[model samples]
Target: MSAVASVVSLVELLRGNPGSCRWTGGLSPVDLARAERELGTPLPPSYRCFLAEVGSCEVDGTDFLGVYRTPAMGDTLLGTVSGTLDARTDPRFPPDLLLIQYDGMGGLVCLDLSRRDRAGEAPVVVWDPGSADRGGPERLAADFGSYALRQCTQALTRGG
Candidate 1:
């Protein structure tokens, strides 16, 4: 599937109401714009379409955090969770694109990068969405789509 189609499918899966699963809050348009501005970059085209169509939060009618796609330098796009505006107060992960926060979950929501189908396992790296690191941006951009697919699958399996 195309990256955009994959994202849409992921969003639909998240919107599924499976028992305890619920629709949580999503980022407001203003908030999204502010985040993009803070990061000093435009979000990915596919991601923009996802947000515009499916929105930034789940549709199950609960208050779970949602995913937003950041700019793609090459293949990967930085991913960020909704409701985390303060990076200092929040334990922002190094590989920020892979970082996620679900409802009622605390601390950094870390996803196993190795479990992803396309990328090889290395140490979990916390990404800084606001600032691109030396060589890190390229890595993230390259692997972001696959990483996102893995994350959505994991979340669905785990009932997150």
Candidate 2:
């Protein structure tokens, strides 16, 4: 199956039976395009599809970041992807690393924009804050689709 198709299917499955994942509908195309322009790079296919077809979600209790403000959710806006990525709140965090989501237990899930894997997409990695300056980030998946599906599997195991 195509990457987008597979990612969409996974989202469907997770939405149907997500344990603690807070899933939501996809974002509008216009908003996603704006985000891409602001980020200065085209998003990977899986993430692009997810944002355009699945919006924000909290899979396995971890809140995934979204790109635009949703009207349904008022002033308490979580934030757009660009905002989170550009924040660089911590000096230890690499500038090329984009924070996607943070697991409740203090580990952050992020994508490396500096290099793209053979599949022409940035790889996702888990950054541990506890060992902040000691070691390198651990690889999560080759791409966002793989990462999301893995998380969905965990959700099913826990909630299904």
Report the number of the highest-lDDT candidate.
2
Q: After superposition, how far is residue 61 of candidate 2 from its true place, in Å?
A: 2.6
Candidate 1 ranges beyond 4 A from true positions? 18-20, 25-30, 50-145, 158-160
lDDT minimum window of 10 residues, candidate 1: 117-126
Q: For candidate 2, lDDT tens digit of each residue in 18-128?
A: 555666667677777767766666777778888877777776565678554657765333444644554566666666666677766776777777777665577888776
lDDT of 1 by residue, 52-159 (tens): 554444332323233444544432222353333443344434423333334242333333344333323222233444333454422323233344545556655665
lDDT, candidate 1, residue 108?
A: 38
Q: Model 2 Cα displacement at 74 (Å)? A: 5.9
| TM-scores vs. true structure, each candidate | 0.43, 0.77
Error of 2 at 85 (Å): 3.9
Clash totals for all candidate models: 18, 0
